[model samples]
Target: MRPSRGLLLFLLANLLLIGLLLHSVFTLLTLLFEDCSNDAIPAIDIPAPDALEEINKLPQYIPKIIHQTWANESIPEKWQKAQKSCRDLHEDYEYMLWTNEKARNFIAKEYDWFLETYDNYPYPIMRADAIRYFILNHYGGIYIDLDDGCERRLDPLLSYHAWLRKTTPSGISNDAMGSVPNHPFFKSVLDSLQKYNRNWQIPYVTVMYNTGPLFLSVIWKEYLPTVKSEETRVRILMPAEYNDHPWSFFGVYKGSSWHRNDAKTIFWMGQHWLLVTVVVFAFCASLYVCGFYAYRRVHLRDSNYSAHASPFSSWSWPWSKNGYKPIKHEV
Candidate 1:
């Protein structure tokens, strides 16, 4: 039996109503999450002041020795070179903090802003997920990146009240960062990351939230007092390479080192091996190409024998050795 026109019309009206209701619900949901995304700071369980103090005593902080890999690099030769570089940096800094339980917990609690997963692979985003622990766990000072080997003493950075360097056109590089316990910058930075993360779904706010130095500068400007003498020593380093030079941790792409992996681990291990491997491979290939060209040139030039020489003249060539020497016997 066919349904009545009224029944069909009623069903259509209900469907339209349902659609409208769902749209309204979705709009409300988006609005609700908007605040969370825009907010810069995430709620964290702060460690007691005494516990934080205890953590500060664990070891002397080294500006180098950011992090290490338990497994060798994918390429052995490259791994060795990177390890040597890390070691050299370690010598300069005296010590790199080892991965320990306290450190892990601190990172999990403090910097677990992103809620990203390593999925069994080490990455910077994972570190971003737990940056707080890294800062709190290590003593003396935090080492920022592994690949960035220090060429000069960071005494200038340490000699000031607080120091931050700007990179390229971007301001305030986070590649090498340092802070004492409970530094306001730390709180402000974390807060900014959390706020941006919270409002991440809002397109405009998401962009703002994901930005590192923007967040940093904003926080520093808002909170930290600027004094002429030793209060804030922020400087931007002129970039040697204009291409792919990132000024802040926020400049990293979604899957890029800053965005995807932890700051400390990526700085320490991810980059050196890749750069070394590429350099070594290029060097080896260049040698082979040059050697092959030289060998071909020498071999061809030394091939003084002419294969197409006439039979009558084969024996009479003046430069001919035994193989092609002209026969003195008259035929």
Candidate 2:
């Protein structure tokens, strides 16, 4: 049996919704989970706790410069200890604290071309997020957040041409990064800073998708596919070698001082993402159903109009006001 018109309409509406949902999911996965399977810095290559001493004496690829940033010269009481931990652990390494004035001055002096973009960032945190990339590209060194303290010597990480720490679920974090000066990956990141620079309106989202970790992750994902040689490849620093293990290089402390109220909503949604997804799907389905019914109502109302009173009603013989009549003479 043939399906009714209403049934066909329902099927079509559902098909459209399904296609839309699939497209959204594909785009999200493409951005958030790209390159998760490979490119991770393997454990075997990392210097174990027992080998930290031997590795420190060996020559390293990255410069012995540790970069950290803040609003001014005076570090806050809360993060001062964490900041000191890195210095105490790496006594021989040079430490550069990028204050607000210093950062803007450096940008203006060395990279005047980016001064406009650097100045126009909607959030101060965006500037902080951006300068780290530029600093890494200009000078080969490890950039770590003030909140992240060094637990072990970072000489092991210096061996990689360029490296970024991986975060939970998917994607990489910019909290800690190391690279040789002018590495292709860092150069790509430098080139991409302005392109990804757009005000998303929301404080948290604008910072993240524009100049924060998400931006870095997206650039890393895109940059990997174009890399033809091992030297140009950006290595992934997995959690185990980062902060998950006792032998991990760094320890995380409380951070996110720049987060606004919107960040809480975002964090809540992340915690209850499955429920949010289900509700969103349900709402879309409900809209489709309601729209289909409204269409059906309009169609039926038009078709069931009074034929005798309406001049533009369906074509019919004069004798048949109801839109049909028998032809007696020609039978």
Candidate 3:
């Protein structure tokens, strides 16, 4: 006997639902596995001489100063204080501070491609953050954030070919960095900028991923394998060595007022992703099975009924007030 039109339609609808459920399951799995937090690079521990001893043995070739600020003549008092702190520590160093216009011109003249990207960035602060990497790559000197005051002399940090400071919460920070000119790591960072430049909707997330600590951290991870020896390796100043207090090299002022994080900042799958995947998969599978069983029950009951029987002769509506009634059919 040929299948009824109702049966065929029911089967087609179930198949479509099943297909959609499968697609959703696969997509969820893909997203869970591909999460950025799952791929966080492990921190590297670079062997170092004693901090006090290292300060005396600075590289002669490395430039003394190269800091950047978008501010022109009217520098903020807090930032100006930070700049002065650095100057007080080392007055002999040639401090070449780049203003917004000068930094723009420099990138346009040397790295024109990067300049284009800098100009077109959705956020202005990203341009400020990005230019420091290119400047450090070209000039090879200390690049400190305007809010980071010198707690102690930074002479010790200059001994390394390239270095970045580890930050709180997690990963390395870009607030204060030092590098030798044309260092392979900084070069890699500059080259990878265009590739990692992604907008993640949230202002804080977008900034972090594109030009802030997260970007530097990811690039640093990629650059680690290329180190053939300790001399050429980039150093990471752990939080203990880079933060506020006399023991640390820099004091961090509460300068960031723009970026704010709320409940949405938390990425659910980022932590315990494997567990989440298992739970989600099981839940979806259960739903699929339940739906399939319901579809089958309705269709199969309709198909197996005797042809002469009325629609409600054998089957009763579970929720009906007059239940289980057998209707008489005309022969």
Candidate 4:
């Protein structure tokens, strides 16, 4: 005999419930392993002498400037104006506005091994983001985004061996990063690029995870515990200190299409992967239980029919017997 629809649904629901439970367990195990692995690695600390007293000491650091655009000629008028702001503030700094070709050439000459992955990057903005960390590692200097305008001389920021700016919602921003040549933190960032390089299928996610602010944030977190002293630690300039007012050190321009959040971004940003898994498991389990209950009810009905209809049946309903009639009246 063919199985009823309820039975089939019950089997399918059971399978779904089992899958969800397994997935939840796997996710928990993976998270645990990763936490333990991170703890196992030894922290690296670099010493910086007199770093606290050397505020506003720009001359001692590299006076080079670096920024990237699609190309020199393709730069928008507003961005060009922003670039001029940096130039006007620090005339002595060797400002270099790298175009695609120039950036490729520089990377090819200095970091040849990174070229394959760099060229294979699915997005231009990803390439733009990745090169800055490498540039700072090879030739220490200030790297700023084209959309960011300079409100004052960046000399004060150059005091530290390295610095990162804080961003909203948590974590550091990569838009404005400064470092001395071969800073250990920057080196860690470069070294981690290939390992963290992932294609998340979404453009924004891929860029952010591989080479954007998220990438930098992860490396910075790992680098933090390694700092044995205040001097060696990377100084973080809070949003208030960096750009609280219009005349703040970095005047940010909002008109940029390169980085925008989407539904996928929001979904990942929520970061409730484990919670979501648990909820799904619960829902599936409930569905399976309901289906099983329905199946069992149908099964019992069928079994009763089979038992009564059989030639050798020993049981029967009391009301189904021949000449069985109620003699009593109303109540």
Candidate 5:
């Protein structure tokens, strides 16, 4: 019967533990809710290299603009080719480079409300990430990272009102996004930026969650639930459509230039995530078992004491008021 009480207490404690875990998962796991990869959204289908004429026939919804950002006009020698690649291909497209000065002034001018928060970001990458969304939302066009080069014409991508490339596992990325000016999704992104802006302490996490792809992805995931029709839906570019294949819209080059030392740890975890998840759950389960049994043992021991009187409590000592006196013949 005493053991039964321990088991009951164990279950009750576990119920609270389970609730907390579920709550954590619901909150931090928002990014996993949507897998925009594959057939989850309208496909950005492009014609083959030989079918150039057909690609031109596609309607252009986004404007003829390509936006990139950096600290200044001096593009790095390593990425110069990539930068030139997009330019050489899209000669007809107007290009705008938002250097640090231009970006800050633009924010101060157009989005004065966000000026304080924008300037207060702990990392330059945060500002870089934030400005791309603002610029895309305001100017309306394709926002490509300087490291990403154009593989072919981007005419097909403009057909969608808004679009993002699907990252691994879940959610969309901010790199190489396309949108018409004032798309609802980017509005969600711009509006949510101020709220998501917080110092995560670690350089990488701060940049990612505050203004990087992870931030954009989370916003897109949260914003997707309210979609009513295709017009407002944000299209996704799958791997094949993005850069994996030869004809993919863009080519990936050396990037993540802002990565700090912690980035290696993060990347390692990502590379071995399944093992990490299993080990974490295993440790938690082991801890739960140990705690449950430890509690049960202590509870049962206390219960046993309650069931009977203590030997010391029953003893009678002659010198104490509670003790019985020796009998006359007791010698």
Candidate 6:
């Protein structure tokens, strides 16, 4: 039976309202639990307390080591030489292995020059994204940044983490992070990186570079207001031991050979790339929505707008004599 004009209008209004309610509900659901999974988190045994204590006392000083594999292959050797210099100051630590496949790709993509020009580097080229995965799957170990080298022993951090714990009054620090052989938190971090790696390539690598370094900034400035508090096993070290960004190292002078202008530029570019990408995506989405509304107002109000016109005919308002009536149907 043909519906009356008033009833048709009411039905359309109700449909719009229902659509909006459903959209909001789905959005909230995604935000609340999209990334959540019930998969089992592998158990990891914490280092033995007594053994960790002994390891802590063995030596506070550790030689700074950088690992890199490049197209040139000479970087591994140069890395060895740099390691020697670090050894002169303290006991030599072996160069960190890159377990992350993306970390290798990152080295190749970001620091192509370093690998090609600089010979004798210590580590092989690996994607930073895959670093944790490789470590978790192949061997249980920790990867430290060469720039953030510490003379102090890490046993305290190792010992303190029976399980992942809170880093701040609220948040967790990704810098100086570690995983037990099969800890759930460790697995989670790897899973997150795996998901991250699949979507973005270069952008994610840049994040891996200073995941912890930037966390240092938050300790001092409190940039990000607060993260959702529901999560667990996120840990942060005391600010003193784990120095973060904007904290100048005393006695360290300018042009310390360690500082490179080019590295700084590259870092900033990565940050800009992410920012621009996000902005562009948002802008495009807004345009699409606005254009859809405009099209609804124009064609839907005209008699030319017909239910059989096109799939886009939803905007057509049949009740109005002038055809171009605003949709008060508030979804």
lDDT of 6 by residue, 1-331 (tens): 3433544565576568657865744432232222211211221222232455545554222123323222342334324443334334334434544433445554466445433321221222223323433343233434443333444334434432212212332233332444445544444443343232222234323343322232222221221133233132333333333443232111111222233345565557545755755786587667656755564556445534343433333333466565443343333
lDDT of 4: 0.68
Tell me which of candidates 5 and 6 scores higher on TM-score: 5
Ordered from best to worst TM-score, the candidate numbers read 5, 2, 3, 4, 6, 1
lDDT of every predicted structure (CA atoms): 0.40, 0.82, 0.70, 0.68, 0.80, 0.37
Residue-wise C-alpha lDDT for candidate 1, range 1-331, written one tens digit per residue: 3533443565576567657865744432332222221212111221222354633443432243244322223424423453455456346554443343444455566555433431221433333433432462333354444334333233333322334444422233454555554544555555555444443443333332344443444454445354243333332222321113321121221222234233444344324645754786587667655754464344334443445423333232245464333323333
Model 5 pairs in collision: none
Of candidate 4, the 10-residue stretch with the lowest lDDT total is 38-47
Give the Å error, residue 270, model 3.
9.9
Give the per-residue lDDT digits (tens) of candidate 3, residues 1-331.
3545654776698688778877744533443332233222222221233455544654544578757565575778767788788878878776777788888999999999887788878887888888899888888889988788887777666657777776644467788888889988888999989997878887877887788876777777666668887556877776666764456778877587446663233444445556766897698778767875576466545545555443434444468767555433455
Predicted candidate 4 versus true structure: per-residue lDDT over 1-331, tens digit per residue: 3555655776886788688877744533333223222212111121122333443333455445654455554778778788788888778887777778888998899999999999999888888888788777777889888888887666666656778876654466788888888888998898999997878888777887789886787677767678876456687766655665543578877644675566455557447656766788688778766866575555555555452332213433356665222222234
Tell me the lDDT of model 5 at 174.
81
2 against 3, candidate with superior TM-score: 2
Worst 10 residues of 5 by lDDT: 322-331
Off by over 4 Å in 4: 1-59, 62-66, 260-331
- Candidate 6 regions with alpha-carbon error over 4 angstroms: 1-126, 136-138, 162-175, 191-194, 199-234, 244-289, 304-331
TM-scores, all models, native as reference: 0.39, 0.79, 0.66, 0.64, 0.82, 0.41
CA deviation > 4 Å runs, candidate 2: 1-27, 31-37, 52-59, 292-331
**Candidate 4, number of clashes:** 0
Model 3 worst lDDT window (10 residues): 38-47
* Clashing pairs counted in every model: 32, 0, 0, 0, 0, 37
Q: Regarding lDDT, does 4 or 6 come out ahead?
A: 4
Question: After superposition, which runs of candidate 3 have C-alpha atoms over 4 Å from their true positions?
Answer: 1-54, 57-61, 260-331
| Span of ten consecutive residues with least summed lDDT in model 6 | 247-256
Candidate 2 lDDT over 48-95, as tens digits, reads: 767857676766889999999999999998898889999998899999
- In candidate 2, the residue pairs with backbone N, CA or C atoms under 3 Å apart (3 or more residues apart, or in different chains) clash, namely none
- Supply the global lDDT for candidate 3: 0.70
